[model samples]
Target: MNQEFYHELGHVVLHIGNQRQMTDSFRRYKESKANHFMYHACVPTFMI
Candidate 1:
């Protein structure tokens, strides 16, 4: 529904883990993936 919800959903869909124990680069990478997913989730291709 909201951007925050999709962002969190991205993490779930991507199977991302806790960032507390992740390296900086790895954390950024995961965050990037989640962000990408968020965008797609927020605006589905079917709607486009």
Candidate 2:
């Protein structure tokens, strides 16, 4: 179950960087936003 959650989270994080509005410029990209959110949310990366 934990592995499943990690897999899903990775997908969400990767997709955020590909969003049309967010992909306009690399500097303004939100690619790391999801990662930061997950870290703060206590989503352990060890499981990933």
Give Cα-based local distance difference scores for all models.
Answer: 0.83, 0.52
User: Which candidate tops TM-score?
Assistant: 1
Residue pairs in clash, model 2: none
lDDT of 2 at 32: 52
What tens-digit string does per-residue lDDT give for candidate 2 at 1-48? 654465458557555434554535652334455445555556566876
- Least accurate 10 contiguous residues by lDDT in model 2: 27-36
Clash pairs, candidate 1, are none
| Predicted candidate 1 versus true structure: per-residue lDDT over 1-48, tens digit per residue | 577898888888886567898899998888888899888878867899
Where in model 2 is the C-alpha error above 4 Å? 1-18, 21-28, 43-48
